[model samples]
Target: MPIPTSNGHASRVQIQEPRTRSPLPPSSSPIAFKEQQGRPPPAAQQTIAGKLSRNLFKGILFSQLTLISLLVIVLTIRGLILASSHHFHPKKWYPPLLASVAVSGVASLAWQCIFIYNPPRAVKATFWLTPILTCSVGILLVLIGSAVDAGIGAVFVLFAITQSLYGCWITPRLEYTDKILSLSTAFPPARTREVVSLSILVSVVYSGFLVTGIGGATSTRTNLDLLFVSVILISLAWTMQVLKNVQQVAISRARYVNFAHGEDMDAWGAFRVTVKHLIGSICIGSTLVPIIVLIRGSIRSVNLMSGSSDEVMYSGADCFSTIANKLITYGNRCGFVHVGTYDKGFVEASSDTWKKLRSTVGLEKLIDSDLTSSLCFLSAVSVGAVSSLTAGIWVLLIHKDYALEVTLYAFIIGYFVGRVALAWIQACVLAYYVAYSEDPQSMRFDGTIPNRIQRLQLLSARRDNRELEVGRDRDDTDNC
Candidate 1:
């Protein structure tokens, strides 16, 4: 066999014993790059081979996201007390609310215990119960909201009803979604509370925004309070999205290293790399989703306030906007996978992810993807509904005045728990898609989900074939 000469030359040279070994190239040598990367020096005393960590953990620095998150936290807190002072009743609201949160926390902890043991069945159960939770919550809230004249309750009821309807719609086609979620359980990340801690922080940030923004809203124009409220809300919106993407990116990086390179990267290490290098990429990557949402919401608000003179025009706008938002959301899910795995910017990652999905999995995988997202979302809210029921009833019987506070706190705690549990599944599943896209052969971690996309593709093709045959038969009958 040819051997790498101790000298930095291509020509073959005789292997020598350790005592007779030649020196390696100095850092300043012309052949340093080639020599460092080339075949190892002859069997002499060579330094131990480098670890994967040396190469795998690297990226250009981007810290803007870190700054933004800090800024939002400060602003949201300031806005919270200044804007919502009137709504907060310390004497009537404090004790019951604290008790409600404690009860909800215990319930939330119990719920998470199920997830810790058998994840799939827990998720499956949650998925099935989403419709029930939504419908019940929607009906009860609508009745109580009407009785108590609570606009916020009505808003939640509307959202709950919509979710209930979607849960019903997605029920029949849930097999693949179940499989998709089940498949993601194959990856068991190390115990890392970074994501959970951030989720709680985010929940707190959201509470501040919800209270302060609602309190600050006014019919009057050109007011500093309203402007400050708008800015806080917007910042909160963007900050949450960016932080979510950050978690996904961190999870992807860890899973990608585990899958693609066979490295054992823990969540903390991956998150550190994310904070050190990929934070800015995540911020830029996640910006468009919030922007699209803001635009759609603004248009809807304008149309509603103006009494919707051109209903058809506004309807068309809604249709297009919804389509665009859904498309971008899907694209972001896939695209962020690329960003996490490769040293690419958001747009390039998105373009590449789309092309890879088209060439390999096609449109059918998107169906399964949609199913997974919908089910996860339903499962999340359903958890919140159950938590609210657990805590709110007890508080309601005694401190009837603080029903809203109890429900809100309980639901938020439960939702935060759900987010902590489910976000990893979503992030890992996307990483799986990206892994399959990058290299299909190495996905032996799970056999069932590897062929799932292919199965979907075949089913799609067969359905199309049947449709074509039916069309041809109809044409023949018409001719006869």
Candidate 2:
């Protein structure tokens, strides 16, 4: 029963496969019986509607509306203060703002189309091509940035190079390459158009936030102005995070409705559920991830820029912050799956999600996509690098002083767009995990994974047995 695994060790893993079946031998295929069972459980019913109908706003007053109010207040204060001055005009934001919106919308739709056509290829290409694009683009930008001295050019180059190298290093080490590749396009493709439109809507709203962001960032002068700008940027970032999470909730709901309840729920219908019932919980859920990320970035930036005498302390702080962010982000994602599935508060949903994951597949199996995650980050950074380069070049040509401002805006917008494009994969994964956890033995969830894994196990078993036979022959020779 012991089989060598990818970790180069043998373990007695009793394969839960090769289930008893009729008409054909069990040796024919690893998943012959269960693979044919594709329909949802008979137990799933319309009672889910009753569970979903309740008003489940957990923290609207303190979380979602508060971010909205803060953004408005900061924007109003900035507008009033700058009413008399011609120094920082919103008119200057027009071109880059339009550019960001257009790029974001087009890039998102295009990426969605790519996935629609071939999910496996898209996933594979993202892992392989994004790194090359990132490295190539990084080197090009580094050359241009060094020559032109454009402000955010240095940041873009560094991000590109770092993300590219990380992606290249991680891809080859991925364990379940075939499993993830097959799982990539396995979702029923009924929910494409609505999600695409929702993304477009998010991109437009994102541009609105960027407009205020563009104005505030370029207009900071006094300490008060700086405070106002920081609040505005942070609030905008939070809103952007909320929008993405909303889509995530919608995708989970859509999958649940289609598969579990045997009903149809398009992106907009699921969006309505999210906007109606889950907005407040989502707002609360979205709050910590972005805030922690902002804090982590601020810490890293401070440490890197300080050129601190005590490198040890700075290094420790940076590592600590980064680890904390990753832990929180991973927990938050699993938690949101529970939130989307049931009408529970953020904390309660997240708690239940952990219990379910631990009891079912364990945390290691669910969150072990290091290569996929790295590729996504690198792809987003690559998009940001392209945006930064294009914006920087234009700004340097026209008005070099504000080149940093425009490039930063472009990078944020481009990165957001890249994330939006990749959102469906994340949504499918979480939804699949939730569905699988609900009915582990019988759930018709991602059939491809089981088959591929069975094949790997068989191969590993054969390899291990061969090695044992060779060892026995050597021992016999030594005895003779």
Candidate 3:
């Protein structure tokens, strides 16, 4: 009985000892191990996604390149076959056109290579859609042109072809900018809508003025018609300049933020900056006035010399307008470069751009190459070709009566629409070049610079070497 009682006391003592003295593993150690194991799947998923995106980009690029190559081959073969049958004439215009085509093809291939080698995350659907829409509209215009009048249709076809080529060339550049900058926010639909609305308004007003001035001039042959024409020209120029400035500001800010490695900028900020600089931009834009006046005067003098014949006058006027527009465009480009580089007032920016151009060797060429005028020409050609072909097919199918009017309207509509879409890309590309020119290092992604950019930087460095050497020599001479 006494042994049994002692056993109960011993059992209690054993239970209390185990409860108090059993050692626990370090607190939350197992939980932390599980957490560490859980973390890697997310990282692994991210890695997989990145690789997939890159692969998809490369695939799209390759497919596009293949298609373009096939198109070029087909075109060349068609031209050759036509020439053999005496259907194709090697006129003065033919050689230049062929040369342009060849150059554009080469430029396109080069551009594709650059993109593939440095593949961005994704190409926006809009980039592809813009050109397609542009071409479609152009084609529609061409069909309309044929129905109305052969001459009008021909003009519409020409315009459509030019627009198509521009779309092809510019779309890629825009895609590159989007990818390079990691601009998740696609082209602002609202901004595009606004531009379209404004452009339409201006175009309508300009068209009215044109009609009125032409009729008045033809009927009255007075100074009043000329005055109306001048008003139309000035107003149209002013509106275009304003729109251009707005686009530049928006794109440049996006580029600037990207270059500085800052957080993404919103549309409102871009719009505000544009509005803030509106007056100054308008003033800077007006610098084109003197040049325009000189062009118009020269055109008038030539017309007078030609005895004011209608056909001769029209041709001369068209030629002069083209020349003047080109000059204005180049000037505007310089201004845009300055704006992108320094984000300064427009006048200051213009001066700065001029100074940079004057001071730097090969800088102009570099800018032109980076911007790729040949590519632009090619793009315009592509757009035009597609449009013309489409329109021709439609004309063949339906044989509509109002084809000429349709062609004219379509040409105008498509050109403006495509222009608006591409303008954003153009502005972004301009800003990209400016930023690169100023500081090539700032465009690094993941601490790595693109090979093309590196090559550019190397070239720029070589160009500047003489200047650096001269400075060094002068310093040594002073020391001596």
Candidate 4:
């Protein structure tokens, strides 16, 4: 048949029978078909088909309790076995333990002096209170751990002890700091409760890992070796999660401190965001772990191959390890900066952090201040040492046969608890640094920005203006 066209030319129209459809090749599976369709595989589809419901708080509680239970059982069994097999001598360990306590106290005092030297009057109390709280919590936890038998009751008693101590002592002091820092203006009751709850959850997880590690150390079973590995992995996972939460809290706190409107994001909401970005954050954190491990491994291999018993080899390795550790730590601090880049993609946040750290007048030094990190460590160490000493004395007087085991347990538990207790304070310090970096003028030092930061801001502004002028002048000349 022919159809007439608009140009007066006749065009032929042909019709043909429809061809049969060919089936997919035998080798092509359903998965392949889905892939061709840009869809997920059936298994994956089914995996996520159910309603996405994860109660993080409940999960945290369950995991913490379960881990604590396992740890207590293992420790209890180990203690029983040790008591039956070996005799403990309190006099043998007493001198070294006491010496350790003395050294820790001296070191803590020295570090505190470095931290508080010529510090602003406003933050002086904050710095002072941190060590005090750390010591108090550490001592209290050790006392509880030493007094109570390893059981479910022990867990409850520990929590009750912590709650009573925090409420009676720490909370009031923290409240005073809140008033000093005007934190109430930023943190409503709901927000404060969320922060406190999350902090407690993190503390529970940290304490569980610590207890598990200590318990595992007393056993030499193959099963415990496996369990130790599991504990390490789980601990790392929880640590990463806690660090991410800290970043979110830091950002929120910074916003509140700056009087930003609509900054009242709930803790659950922040946690959800953290979960959404968990993979990316883990990838960022994990990259450093492997590199550090590989470097240390390589150094060890070189030492073995060289067979050089020289001090130079050891010193070099130590130096490299320190550098690697600092690099990793700096990377961690950068995570908080990434948090400050609100709603930005992970790549962009990482890039921005890199740029800032590389900047000549940037906040790298301020954010990675030795005062913040060292003080926390020293505080924990000091408290742990003192707890060890106390446990030794108690064992000497009461449980003379179980002196070594109890003292070791107290020292390890106390140190971990102390560190976890101060984690919130560290978050706040990071938040302050972030706020200052974002807007120096917004930070309140006695109700006004600090003179040094204000001057730095002015200098930065002027430098930016000059760069703009230079760029514009070059553009005008190029046009001519």
Number of backbone collisions per candidate? 0, 0, 17, 0
The sequence of per-residue lDDT tens digits that candidate 1 reaches over residues 201-295 is 45554544343333323211237645644554455445545566777776775555454444445666556556655555576666654465456
Which parts of model 1 have CA positions greater than 4 angstroms off?
1-88, 93-112, 143-175, 193-234, 290-331, 361-370, 386-417, 443-446, 469-480
Superposition error at 252 for model 3 (Å): 0.9
lDDT of 4: 0.42
Please, what are the lDDT tens digits per residue for candidate 3 over residues 1-480? Answer: 000112211221211122222222232122222221121111112244534443454354346435533433444454444554543333321222222223322332333233223223213333343345445544554445444454454554465466556546655355334343332122221243343344334443333333232222323224754564354444434444455456655555544444333334443445455554333443354444345446645765665576443796778767765775455444545465444333444445555555544344444544543433333323333333333333334433454442332233223322322233234445555554444444443422222224444556677789799878987998999999
Report, for every candidate in turn, its global Cα lDDT versus the true structure.
0.52, 0.55, 0.41, 0.42
lDDT of 2 by residue, 202-247 (tens): 6666565546644654564667666755665565556666777877
Candidate 2 shows a clash count of: 0
Residue 90 in model 2: lDDT: 52
Clashing residue pairs, backbone N/CA/C < 3 A, model 1 = none
- In terms of lDDT, which candidate is strongest? 2
> Using Cα atoms with residue i matched to residue i, what is each candidate's TM-score against the true structure?
0.63, 0.66, 0.41, 0.45
Superposed Cα deviation of residue 433, candidate 2 (Å) = 1.6
Report the C-alpha displacement of residue 370, candidate 1, in angstroms.
5.0
| Alpha-carbon runs more than 4 Å astray in model 4 | 1-190, 201-262, 267-330, 340-351, 357-362, 368-370, 386-390, 400-405, 441-450, 453-480
Top of the candidates by TM-score: 2
Which parts of model 2 have CA positions greater than 4 angstroms off?
Answer: 1-93, 128-155, 173-192, 216-220, 257-264, 289-330, 361-363, 370-372, 446-480
Candidate 1: RMSD over Cα atoms?
13.6
